[model samples]
Target: MRTTPRRLLAAMAALTTALLASACGGGDDGGGRAASGELTMMVPLFGTAPDPKGEVHQAVEKVVGKKLKITWVPNAEYGDKTNVVLASDDIPQVMVVQGKTAAFVQAAQAGAFWELTDKLDRYPNLKAKSEQAELNASINGKVFGIYRVRPLLRSAVLYRKDWLDRLGLKVPETVDELYEVAKAFTEKDPDGNGEKDTYGLIIPKWPTPVFCSASPYNVIETWFGAPNCYGDRGGRLVPAFDTEEFYTANRWLKKMVDEGLVNPDFATLDSGKWNDPFVQGKGGIIIDVNVRATQLYGLLKEQDPDGYGDKLAMGGNLKRSDGQKFSYPFDGYNGFLAVSKQSVRTEAELDEVLKALDRLATKEGQTLLANGIEGRNFKLENGYDVPIDDDDPAVKTINNDVDFAFVQLGTWATIGMGVYESMPTSEAERENLRLRKELAELDLQTAVHNPALPIVSPTYVSRGATLDPIVSDARVKYLAGEITEEQLRAEVKRWYDSGGAQVVAEITDLRAELGAGGN
Candidate 1:
């Protein structure tokens, strides 16, 4: 019954494969001629896919000196598709691997990707990447890809400035002050609606583990003097959850939940809807990246052009009882652009692809990636590029289209490529950007790093999926009062018995080999 469709699909697939081989200029030794024809790339799409004929695409093609053939996979299906692609021999020439996952590591080790550690030094822009970002992107000290730069530190407390102003409360500087402010926001009707319908904090079901920098719990734990993910405890790396500060922070959060200051459905709330409650006046706090404050303010301005004036604000990490501050730091990269050996097939082909990427990292290329074709998407005024309003559908379609495919191909944040040319269109946007910069600087002064992030563990790589859930599940249970402190400790012990100890031992050895200080 299925033979007709199956045969037809198989014939179509073969035709596509043959076409790609012809266009890619199949297998020739590195010589006078560089790799010819269109370069193929696979990248995840956040929203609508960019048009191949768009001005942005054409500009990028001109800069890179190659016609690009890109496959736009949706974000939700990327992980599964990446796994399948890694297992096959038909990978794209350039692929955006989202993380250094077990499959990616194994594939890289097996020669599926070109080893790029020593090779990067040949390209000035690639070599100029931040040391930490490169380290975090490596697999057991070997680099197989060029990392996409993200901030080393970006987390902050995003809160309702208007609520704090109305309640006569200052931005919280200490843990105790944060708690009291939360209580006030919950008890007092800061919205002036004469109804106690709003809570203090809006915690969603966080997507990552509790130890990740993105987790609000990790933010509070680090502020309470716990390590970032893993800490040097007694000359050995240990999970942050094992520390007393972690429990203290959790107990404080639990108290907030018990007091009804936090959302009751936080454990099950969708992260996609995290900002909805804040926008709807049902919550007053969200601990996230600094840019979220600007985004929330922008949303509020759009909703109530006259009423919502400076409704959101951001601040650095809180000080502890002893007046010591600690800040959670990002992993310093989003993902990497890996050149596949299968599609490239030769040194010359690899060089051609890397050269295109090198051009993409330059100031001119970075400017194009970030702002798009200047006169079309933005206009220069007062020595800054002010983005034109994208209200026009035609303008919006062509704006930032190339970025969807190649934005992650540059080391912009880490190497500081291009000019800081963007000027906010509004006074409110300007104020928000200024405030974010100030708070981010404060956070950087007390950044706490995870010593284990760069070090690879065989046990963790093989059993991390199993090992991580043991701690994360217990943590969620502990927070919800489903388990007591004693039970939580038991779960931690269980984790140690289940490959965590091996992971710790490996990390300790690796750190020692690298001569990294325990602190």
Candidate 2:
């Protein structure tokens, strides 16, 4: 059970009672408290790995003095499931959604969630978090949802430093340099096996190239001498797939293949290979998420402590002509929570839920989220959070059995930066601090944040969801020498022809409004 404060827990139990009586008929806009034992909560399964429990959440339940009874929902199938549930108008007392933020917006508009803007102060915990995080609760001026609190980071290239040094190469800081390193790494075995068993790098798109426009590679296309892919010239938000940067990156990738740099089978590179190759000491470089670097370090320390400690290097973005560091686009706003109009029939109920979510957004929440049941799951030593007796077989068993993935740490909202949310164990904290510093020191030549990231729209965010697969397939075939770049170009034209133009228009419009197209 979660260790929510006793008072907050009581309030939740009280809210559940309110949910029972007013849950029917779309809840009233006034204050409400369902009758106890009536409300159910739904949340996307927090852990994608084998572990199923969240200790902080358990603490929340414990604090509430009752089981919230949260059912696990998969993010992949969220849209379909949400639609089905919404169609039936049968929802849990609390629903923490993931995936498809636009749908959330639409749902909230249709009176799906409870509004708490007018009743935020009652839950001091939630209110405090919201204020500290500067979390946005309103969209286009309407209070719609509360964002899931996580910090922001500039993503970068992850490489095996040992391999680079072995190959006598410095970290590549430009597209051209990236190519050169890939080639040399390809030709010269960095693994010391003396066999051509490894590829220079492994940024997979297999069987096709896959990139997130909000990613530095896609959004900062212009820095690579390509058009900026984030928005249309008109300042309207557009999809990255429809942008010229998409084609440019592909072309660059194709050239790498032609030059015997990147693996031709890259398009079909499996996730295991993408991560495992580097972990096992095969591939050298990867454009990875900010979290994975730390996660990889953890995995390495556990599996091959010495090798992990000695082998890896977290690199920054490749620089542009002017030596600007670039970053890929990532969703800035994590999802939000809103009150259902039906529930606010009273201010107190609205206050209750708002308070709960808000509390989950700040430091107290950060501590609980990352560390889990303070004295129980962990011990604080010198202001650092550490798992209890981590070396103990019992501790290991419990950690493996539970409290693994719940440690979603390092959000700008939580610590204002990655430097602050590191592991509390002196050792763990050292690794995190070092890694965080590595990220910070990455000379970002061009801080090209994903252009379309701010706009809340379907056409932009979802455009690549379908086309990315297609492009990936086509690019893979071409890179493996199966298809021509000309063919790839034609396909890109097809993309532009099919809804790409519209996306461009949207981007242009968005940009014009923000006065963002000057560069």
Candidate 3:
């Protein structure tokens, strides 16, 4: 795939082990003469981002009893940059990669990383959580990386509940009813603006014709009670793409296109473009990713203030007409952080960083993860983080400085499926939280959204070269009707013929070997 995280920073200093020892190994770490040094971190942030510092960094320093100097070399073009780093004997202390699965495996085989499996006990937090989760974000049955945990909720249909109520329409749970509601949204102007300028629904654009990459087919596919991309049946791995239910979904989409119910350019609409119709008050029914919904709600309030502020109501994953919910989670996220072989000169120091991560995973850590500091970042208003009270000075500091708050800590990643409230506000946004929780429950209730699918790491390594074009070509042709169902099958078969099948087969074998064949 086209590697990201590489086009981050090119201006990095190369250091020898001697420099690292002098800089980080000999210093007052966490009160004792602990290791005090600087190490380069291949952070997700590019743009000359300094190494970890301040309270968050300090907390980590405390955990490890060492001072860590961080240099961020963004994930924008991460995979290829990492490849470059790997070939050279000199590299950063650490690299948190996005899609480096194959690269990691290849690197491990070449003795490119510090195998931390036996050493994990040194840090109890990492050990417990990793063990707790059966932490398998590794290669060859050995723990090769530290996985960051976040919510696993995805694939649910959201509708304007208030609109349905206003029109005396029951929230649809069947294919026929869903179409009817979408049609009414177009014909009825569910927003009650007294104008029929609104369409009923929207489906975000899917990339097509070149590579049949998975896109937002769940909204339609789920309505048919079938998984669009992947799902589970009897705890066995399955592709809903092969089912007649999928055909029903496609047929429904075709009809929607013919009737102008869903946005015509849905195949091209991403979060940005997809939500435009919703924000402009031009759509009633819209299908969205979980995180995008929160963003859309915020934008609507900002754009119109009065229009969509409280007007928008979100919901949990909708049940398919067949009582099944489409699970959209993709093998969980591949945010495992790995230590480079070049950085192993100071494994003890690196262990400290892992310790800090372990702490952040706890309740106290979760508190800081949610609210920065007690009085500075946020204050507890009825057991909720409220920054709008102005009692904290760090609110602005965090707002400006803390970009990693969402990812490093758990809050951002877990913000959906229920926590979409007014953080640091007087009253929790119950409606927001409720909608998210409802959706979360829907995901949890569904047997599909697999939490343990040994999904290949989304690294921008080798697979993309072969995988991308096929997905692009397939997606485009299928949506454009240039390819019939037979064509789609032939294309999928080509994935097998051209090694995608082999890839899947390999993954299947690996999962089985791991005793995780339960997919």
Candidate 4:
């Protein structure tokens, strides 16, 4: 309803005609230009855009055997810019689409982009794909983009080992133990300054309560046996909040708040400063991605190098009271690189583009993008790449180029993309990497995925913005003790009455049509 095919077709009639004409009116090969050694791409820039003359850029060009013309749009403005580009005639050859927005879905369905579902196999590196990633990125059961890869099981509990040692509390392996540890951390003066100024958890105000990915609350919910976002109930797919496990998890989290174990301002605390409490020794626990442990360790080491060792500890998802482990899983990809049909014009051009991307996924190409020129950006230290300090002006520019440009184009996280290993020089780094790998493998065995991730529900899309807040607001109210359990149930029923029931029915039928089994 929000973005009907009819509406999109009407809105894009002019642009669609232009795109078709361009594709048909190109050169002899039907490609807009000859098979030049140049490729134009658009990507979101999270930091300052790198200088074009930087060494890293040149290194990447040399490795990929192509002159790269990158349009670095600020991340915040990328979505808007993408919308504009989707409606214009001057589209880039390749673009990094952040998500399958309604406009993007319409554009893709209208054949604005090349469908690479069967084409990826021609390139070995690009052909290596994760099943979960493919499922999440598909549009109408077809692949339109080469998805960027991420870890499938990225959740972990981060805690302060120093605080635990001082209080004689062991690392929590179960939800009940975690509660007890949190209580002790809050009430037992774990800081040992003879003052109770610390709390157990450092939960910030989550960005959205609907998606709930990466939220500490979501971690607790999944550990309590709730699904990641949606759960399959008797062949019926429904939102996770509709499950009994979600209710139980909410009650448990509310208990923590009522007992003053978690940060009081968790509802309003900025996520940007979520680590500040841990750094200031005001909190001792953070349930987040495992990679955060390495980052936190680095920050602590920067402040106190000698004492930072063994000061931090990491763990995978905790077990429920029944000793069953369940994990919150990432979608295994960020976004994807989509090639434009108008720009590519022909299958041969598409092949050339895919080949270049395949090369980027190779070991030599990945190393160049990630580590830069060996002697310039890093030095071989005992056969391991040791990054050079960026204090020098030249090194700083290279580092910026790495972060702001080359790294953004990396697909190294894709399974079998290429090997880009670096040895850890410190105990913290070693353990962090070890646990990251170990926990990822362990959690994957028990990860719970959302069945509705790939489903296209018209009702949900149109009414989702209105429908989600019903549960999200109710959950917040229940956590704040402003509403009773009965009130929360009533709110959920209200959601079903409004539009959620229709969403459930549609998703159930669609799942059946797609032959998607239970989670």
The most accurate candidate by lDDT is 4
What is the C-alpha lDDT profile of model 4 across 1-519, one tens digit per residue?
111111233344565565555544544432554177888899888777877677777777776778888899998788778877887766788888877665567668777788888888889888746877787677655788888777778889999889999888888989999999899999999888999898998888877656345578777888988877778888788777788999999899999999998999888899999888997899999999887866687789888888987678888889999999998888777678899886787778788888888988887777776666677767776656677776788888886776566676777542122244466758677777877889889889998887777676766655666776687778877898899999999998999999888988997888888787767
lDDT value, residue 135 of candidate 1: 74
TM-score of each: 0.88, 0.74, 0.77, 0.91
Displacement of the residue 27 alpha carbon in candidate 1, Å: 6.2
The best candidate by TM-score is 4
Q: Model 2 residue 163 lDDT? A: 78
- The C-alpha lDDT values of all candidates are 0.75, 0.51, 0.53, 0.77
> Where is model 4 more than 4 Å wrong at Cα?
1-30, 413-425
lDDT per residue as tens, model 3, 1-519: 111122222222221233333333333332121133444455555233423555655654454344555545455565566656655555555566554345455555455566777776776555535342334354535666666554545544556655777888875655577789888887876878888776777766553321212355644565566653444456444445545777677777767766878776666667557667776667766655555556666766677555454445554455556565545443344466666554554666666556655664555555544445566655666666556545444455453333343234341223332122345221224555556657666666553433223345232233445654564556456766677768877766676576655544554445556665342
Q: List the lowest-lDDT window of 10 residues for candidate 1.
A: 1-10
Candidate 1 backbone clash number: 0
List residue ranges in candidate 3 displaced over 4 A. 1-40, 46-60, 75-77, 116-124, 127-136, 191-196, 207-214, 218-240, 303-310, 345-353, 360-370, 388-395, 404-428, 449-463, 469-472
Per-model root-mean-square deviation over C-alphas? 6.7, 8.1, 6.2, 3.6
- How high is the lDDT of residue 499 in model 1? 81
Candidate closer to the true structure by TM-score (higher is better), 3 or 4:
4
User: Which candidate model has the greater lDDT, 2 or 4?
Assistant: 4
Candidate structures ordered by lDDT, highest first? 4, 1, 3, 2
Model 1 CA deviation exceeding 4 Å by range: 1-34, 209-213, 345-349, 383-385, 389-394, 413-425
User: Cα miss at 397, model 3 (Å)?
Assistant: 3.7
